[model samples]
Target: MDLSGENFRIMILYDFKSNLTVQKSFVRLRTAFEDEAPCKTAICNCFAEYKSGRINLSNEFRDGRPSTAVNIDGVRRMIETDRHVTYHEIQTSLGIGMN
Candidate 1:
């Protein structure tokens, strides 16, 4: 079964309500989701962040490079530079993978 976004919220709620330790939460989630469970490290880190008041039920922005490949100007510039460029060439030049 694929994990739904709501599952994360549920897990976090479970953690909060039960005050389960990270390892216990990990095991609980593993059993709850079976093979579809998220990685143990991710659960541990998320719980740690929650306990530290670093994140809430929702995701928060942190430090990271802003996505640039989808910018209209960037795409326009790439096309203007080489109208004959293949998709592979554009991906290589822009350092962005296609969806």
Candidate 2:
């Protein structure tokens, strides 16, 4: 699937509620998993995974979710790691130049 913009928001919402971070929510869900023993459906899969002690919720979501931020970070890390890279390289590809 094309997981670009809208999908990103969906992921954020899925990961966070109100003001709680995804990590904190997963920790809470993990504790509940031991008590609730919820169903095997996909909607509850993340909670299940946390319950089963299989994987952290964030990691599960991280694997399932598409990350445009990671893509940008990768490019930035590459540029930082390699001095040869330049804004001109990107600009020329887009047919734009610094003023």
Give the alpha-carbon lDDT of every model.
Answer: 0.70, 0.47
Clashing pairs in 1: none
For each candidate in turn, the TM-score is 0.51, 0.21
Stretches of candidate 1 exceeding 4 Å from the true structure = 59-99
lDDT per residue, candidate 1, 1-99, as tens digits? 676645675676578668888778778887888777767777776776667776555445542365554556776788898898788877787677776
Error of 2 at 73 (Å): 42
TM-score of 2: 0.21
